[model samples]
Target: MNAKRKNKILTWIATISFGVISLIALFPIISLVISSLRPSSELMRQGISFSINFSQLSLDNYLYIFNQAPEYWAWYGNSLVISAITIVLSLFFSSMVGYALAVYDFKGKNFFFLLVLLILMVPFEILMLPLYQLMINTQLIDTYFAVVLPMVVAPVAVFFFRQYALGLPIQLMDAARIDGSTEYGIFFKIMLPLMGPSLAAMAILQGLGSWNNFLWPLLVLRSNDMFTLPIGLATLLTPYGNNYDVLIAGSVLTIIPIIILFVFFQRYFIAGLTTGGVKG
Candidate 1:
């Protein structure tokens, strides 16, 4: 085939492939929203069908969820708190570490960067036992601090920020130093403003990770009051069967903040990913 003909064929194939994948990913979310809107009676009648009766749409499930399941609200609040704190702490610490790695000249700097990569290779499951034991010794179990303190520093965020920072011009830092700007001033006044995209991306990633975290929270938090959104939603399933409407509603609610964050910061989020990949 000619080059143009082959290119056309490849483009058509790629477009069709993407369309199929998009529909596959979209179907579940569409089904969840449809199910959440339908009344329980209609849902039962449908028997796994995606169809919903528009006339039977009601907010009772969501209202009942809030009124009956007070623990759900507690879990929601705990998740928000933990995610917010984790994002702030992670951004601060990661930026500092990444800046050091990107700018400073010192012995063992490459070794330290390798160590960050090494830590990322170690899965969280491997550290859980020792982490649990440490939490127990520190009497941190069943407390908010137990969840927030452990995740304040994230290797992935550090790696991302460092790569992004590497793309910055060293001339700017030298100029700032020549102008008598302190190291802290150069970071806060110069580097940080330039790092907005990467920071937004890191914040979104860290927030989602912290909010959806179940295993660590399950290990540390035993009380209903201490549960995060995922753990609380999991409790909605009983031995009999799951309440499909309520479960869907809870799941929808859990994803709202993430969707909102992406909607508002999507441009920066995309730029950050593209820049990081290029620099790396």
Candidate 2:
């Protein structure tokens, strides 16, 4: 084959491969949606199925979630608030920490960065007890602060930003300083814009993590009214009965914000993740 024909053939192969992969990944979402449309009787019989029985589907699940489930909306709003706060705080603090580590030559710089890496290496489960105790002592339990505080400075995010920042042009900081920019201005004005990919990548990841986070929030939030979506959803199942109709429908809706977030940041996501690792 000619060179042009060879390139076309390779492109077609890649397109077909990715298309198939996309369908496989999307299958769960499709199943969840279909399951939501099914009645509890139908769902309990076979569980979430891929097969369609148009006659068996109904709008009852959506109707119930919208009209009857006040607790569901409260849980959703709580999740939205918590996830939003967590994402904003995590990105702001983690980026600054990472930027400083990458750019500055402070006294214990290497040691601090080393400490971050060490902390990153340690699993959250190992540190959960101490963190929970810390929350309890601070009287932050049952408050949004309890969930948002511990995640504000994620070690992994710090590490990602630091690595990405290392690849940035330090000369720009010097130039800004020469032009009478303060250190904060130098970062916010010059360095931060350059770190766009890292920010976008982290925003999506942190948003997803916070949105799906069940364990820490479960531990901290005491009131039923204060519960996040994951925790609230779990309450739908009991030994005596299960509300698969509302649960499945609510679960499908839960993915909407995540889908919107990923779609918005997708262009930058791949670029950010790839570039962040390139430096360190």
> By lDDT, who's the top model here?
2
**Model 1 C-alpha lDDT per residue in residues 158-223, reported as the tens digit of each score:** 898888888888899999999999999999899988988789888877887798888999899889
Off by over 4 Å in 1: 1-21, 41-47, 242-245, 268-280
Model 2 C-alpha lDDT per residue in residues 1-280, reported as the tens digit of each score: 6999999999999999999999999988888888888887778777766566889788899999999999999999999999899989999999999999999999999999999988877878887889999989989999999988878999888988998899999999899899999999999988999998789888877777798898899889999899999999888876433678778899989987667766887776565445435436
TM-score of each: 0.85, 0.86
RMSD for each of the candidates: 3.5, 3.3
lDDT of each structure?
Answer: 0.83, 0.87
Superposition error at 128 for model 1 (Å): 0.5
Instruction: Report the Cα lDDT for residue 56, model 1.
Output: 77
Give lDDT for model 1. Answer: 0.83
